[model samples]
Target: MKTLTVPDETPVFPLRWVVATNDEAAPLVIRLMLALVLFPHGAQKLFGWFGGYGFDGTMQYFTETVNLPYLLALSIILIEFLSPFLLVAGLFTRVVGVLISLLFTGIILTAHVAIGFFMNWNGSQPGEGYEYHLLIVAMAVSLLISGGGKLSLDSKLAK
Candidate 1:
C-alpha cells in the first residue's frame, strides 16, 4: 500500500565519472617524460637553479629581449613553473597538456621556427631549431588525447 522511492546513482563529483583504465599506460609514459623535461626548465626560470636566470632576469629576457608583453612574460613563467608541477602530479591532465602545447607553439613561433626543423648539429648556429618543440607538441597532444595514465593522481582522484 506504500509508494516506493528510488535513490539516484549519479556521482556528486565530475571526475568520478571519468574512470581510469589499464589502457592508460601510454599516457603515463608521456606524462612522466613531459614532467621530467619541463620541471627542470621551469626550475631554471623560476628559481635560478641549474644555471637558469632567476625570475627578474628571465622576465627581462622574455619581455625586453624577446619583445613579449609584460603580462605575456608573466603568463609564460607561471605556466612553465605551474604546469610542470601539476603535470607531474597528473592533475588536470587535458588542461595542462593544452597549456604546454600553447607554450611550445609560442616558443616555436617566436624563437625556433626561423632556425629550421633540425637541431644545430655542428653547434655553429646562432640559436636552436624547432625539433624539440615539435617533440613536446607531439607528447602534449598525446596526453591531451589520453588524459593522465595509471599511477597518476588524476586516475586516483577519479576513483
Candidate 2:
C-alpha cells in the first residue's frame, strides 16, 4: 500500500490582510449601523422575531412565491440571519461585507429594480424599491474597503 501525502498550501481562512483594519471611528460606526439595521431583519427571518415569518415560512415563500432555488433561499436566510452577529463582532468584516453586497445586489436585480428607485412611502406603489438595498450595498462596500475599524476584532487580529 502506498501512502499519499497532501500538499501544503496557503490556508484559506484567517488571512491577515483580509481582516486587517484601522483604529478609526468611521468604519466602526458604519459597521455598527449596518449590524443594528440588519439584526432585526435577520432575526425576523430566522426566529420569527419582529413579525417575521421565520425559517419555514420564509423558505416556503421564497421557493413557492418568489421562485427561488432552495439553496439560494437557504443561503439568503442564513446570511441575513447570521451575518449581523459576525458583523457586530467585526470578524471577517470584508468577507461579510462582500456577502452582504452580493446578497443585496441579487435582491435588487431580482425584486426591486422592477418596482423603481423610490420606496413606497405611501401605499401608491405596488411594491418597495431598490433604494434601501442600494444603501446597504454602499455600507457593505465601505466595510470592504475600510475594514471593521476601531475596537474591531479585525484590528486585534491584524496585530
Candidate 3:
C-alpha cells in the first residue's frame, strides 16, 4: 500500500472579503492626518486659535465678503468646529465627514477657486489656494466612504 500526503490549507475569512476587501489601514490614516490638519482651522474660526479668524471675524468674512446670510455663516461655523471635533475623537464620523465634505465644497467654490494654485498668504496675490481645500475635500470624501476605523469612537460606541 502507498501512503499519500495531503497539503494543509488555511481557512480564509469570507466576511472580511465582504466588508473590507483591502487593507483597512488607509482610511484610518487619512482620518488622523486630516483631523490634525483641519481641526486647527476650525479652532481658529470658532475660538481664534492658530492665527485663525474667530467667530466675529469669520462672521464678518461670511457676511460682508462672501455675501452669505448670518444663518448660513452660523451653520458653517457650527459644522466646521463641531464636526472636526467629532472626527478627531472618531465619533459619529460618517455623518460628520459628509457634512464637512459639503462644507469644503462650498468654501472651495466660493472663496478658494479664484485664488488659483499658489499659496499666497497675502490677499494681494492670487494663490495656490484651492489646492489645499481640494485635498481636504478628498480626505473628507474618503472618510465618508470608509467611516471611522477600529481606532475610532464610532467603533467603540458601536460595541
Candidate 4:
C-alpha cells in the first residue's frame, strides 16, 4: 500500500481580517442602535411579538402575497430574526451589514418604491414609503465600512 503525503503549505483563512475592528465609539453606537431598532422587528416576525405575524403568517405573506420564492422568504425571516443577536455581539458585522443592506434594498424595490420617499406617518398613503429602508441601508453601509467598534466581539477578535 502506498502512503499519501500531505502538502506542507496550508491555506490561511482571513478571519481576523473579516472581523477586524477599531476602538472607535461611533461604530459601537451605530451598531447598538441598529441592533436595538431591528430586534423588535425580528421578534415580530419570528415570535409574533410586537404585533408581528410570526413565522407561518409572515411566510404566507411573503410567499402568497409577495410572490417570493420559499427559500428567499425563509432567508429574509431568518435574517431579520437572528441577525440582531449577532449584531449585538458584534460578530460578522460586515457580513450582517451587507445582508441588511441587500434585504432593505430588495424591500424598497419590491414593496416600498411605489409609495415614494416618505413614511406613512399620517396614514395618508396606501402603504409606507422607502425612507425608513433607506435609513437602514445607510446604517448597514456604515457598519460595512467601519466594522463593529469598541467593546465588540469583532474588536477582541481582531486583537
Q: Relative to the true structure, how large is the alpha-carbon lDDT of every model?
A: 0.81, 0.90, 0.73, 0.88
Per residue, candidate 3 scores C-alpha lDDT tens digits across 22-110 of 23667668777887887787789899999988999999999999889999999888887777567666776677777878988988887
Off by over 4 Å in 2: 1-14
Best by lDDT: 2
TM for every model, in the order presented, reads 0.85, 0.89, 0.75, 0.89
Compared with the true structure, what per-residue lDDT tens digits does model 4 show for residues 12-38?
335656787889999888888898999
Q: lDDT tens digits, residues 66-87, model 2?
A: 9999999999999987888888
| Model 1, span 1-159: residue lDDT tens | 333333665444444424332445788888888988988888889889899998999999988898889998888888888887777778888788888999999899988999898899999888899999999999988887777887777777665
RMSD of each: 5.3, 5.2, 10.3, 4.9
Stretches off by above 4 angstroms in model 4 are: 1-13
Error (Å) of candidate 2 at residue 51 is 0.9
The lDDT, on a scale of 0 to 1, for candidate 1 is 0.81
RMSD of 1: 5.3
Query: TM-score: which is higher, 1 or 3?
Result: 1
lDDT of 1 at 43: 83
Candidate 3 weakest lDDT stretch, 10 residues: 14-23
Ranking by lDDT: 2, 4, 1, 3
Steric overlap count per candidate: 0, 0, 4, 0
TM-score of 1: 0.85
